[model samples]
Target: MSLDVTSPPVLSDVEELVPSRYAVRIGEIDVLVISDGVLPLPTKMLGHNVDQRARAAWLNDMFLPPDAFDWALNTVVVRNGRQTILIDTGLGMDPALNLPRAGQLVKRLKAAGIDLGSVTDVVLTHMHMDHVGGLIVDGVKEQLRPDLKIHVAVAEVKFWESPDFSRVDMPPGFPDALRAAAKHFRKEYESQLQLFDEEYEVVPGVIVTRTGGHTPGHSVVRVASGKDRLMFAGDAVFAVGFEHPEWHNGFEHDPEEAVRVRVRLLRELAETGALLAATHMPFPSVGHVAIEGDVFRWVPVFWDY
Candidate 1:
């Protein structure tokens, strides 16, 4: 169902604790990376290598100073002309997940000068809890933006909504809340969601491209205007080094396929020189991909705004 942008969704009693920040603007497109909050992930969950000495040395080399690994939950907001689009909503309130700063998306949206009612579309890169948690409020009957149209990948929708997922054993150390949330997303809200295959455009210049592996039907968004372009590469690549062109995350559903797609995307971005926006890469998670010998490097661009 399509939603009216002028009077979209209403977020009642929701408070915004953190202020919004703009990443950078490329031409007419103003991109803002809003924070939902932060998450503490076990360092070992990032990859498979478990050797203590090797892990410590790698951490020291990478300058990831002590303590538990903290991940910033960043959602990308793109504005072009009259259209305002949000890619991947942040983690909403769920006590089970132990996310203290959850349900902060609407506040950040407002801080970015984007009325929840003005959001034209919400393109979900996948059905993971972190990506779709903000789509609906916990106790509210309707969505945050009841009038907004939600675009989702066909494969992702099928997998998450399918009955088979219930039978699959939860991976060791996977949070129970996240697993439950994924199941709820599949059963409760699958009808209101719009599914797209391969490539589809939400408006004129905002396009969705299929980039599977992380999730069965995962995808990425490419926003363009004139000569400038930015690729909102959801979880296609995680952390800075995951963009190594050959590296794949251990959290991926299919590591081999994930690596293959990562390599292909790196080459494509390198050849085209498009701006890269990763959900898990540092704050404002936007940058440019550069080829360094056999591997690729992330060159972050700070927004002057």
Candidate 2:
């Protein structure tokens, strides 16, 4: 029989042709990077402070479109044999926001053999809708254990009570949508909220530390075991952030302070040579940070098939 080279390869469920989850061992701990799907956003959102020409140049250099780009939505699962920890939930289907592609976290997690009930701890980077929206999806709360602990910075909950959006430069309806989503999440999960002051250890090797700046309660998770270290850097670092740590992302509530946080985190990563992953980096976002002159570089890890 002749081979059909042009035909697409057969998949188990036919749900997706491309891979949606990647697994790696961080020494004794097991780490998984799951795709929540992509969000198409304007290039200007990357850095509104920089001139359009500069943004255009960078996008071109990367062989991307000039007008917009798809921001990768990655959520991570960490298992230390004792607890199943979820770091940041991805965006759920929000009809009001018209983002249909996002909110794939629930289904994708199931495909990866993880059940909502099995997730004992949730370490939130902040109270942003994309980071917590998946937990508030219809019927999601009912499936989760009643005692599920959601770890978030104490300042995150208070900020949404009377959020100040004066400094952010989001799209026309984003500020309103963000405020409502955060409010709804808090109301739905109030009983499960595990508020932390600055730093908290989730498990034997996984610890979360507040970085502030992106949001007052923005945080990052560090996992270390047997000389292996990886940072789940939430929104503190982005695709462009590695090269232009000074540029202000439009979503940042305090852009100037966000810049400082990015610089500090990047510097630390370069010095430590730890693996780096962020919410909006490309799928399987694990990588290492390197310093090049005055700027930093992202060296993505090679995928092992």
Per residue, candidate 2 scores C-alpha lDDT tens digits across 1-305 of 97768877676652678889988889999999999999888999999999999999999999999998999999999998879999999988689878888999998988888999999999999988899989889989998988899999998888889998888778878888788889999889898899999999988899999999999999999999999999999999999998898988888999999999999999999999999999999998999999999999999999977
Clashing pairs in 1: 3-147, 9-145, 156-217
Q: Which candidate comes out best when scored by lDDT?
A: 2
Clash totals for all models, in order? 3, 1
Task: Report the lDDT tens digits of candidate 1 across residue range 191-216.
Answer: 66778888889877789988887777
> Would you estimate the TM-scores of all the predictions?
0.84, 0.96
Error of 2 at 155 (Å): 0.9
Each model's C-alpha lDDT?
0.70, 0.91
TM-score of 2: 0.96
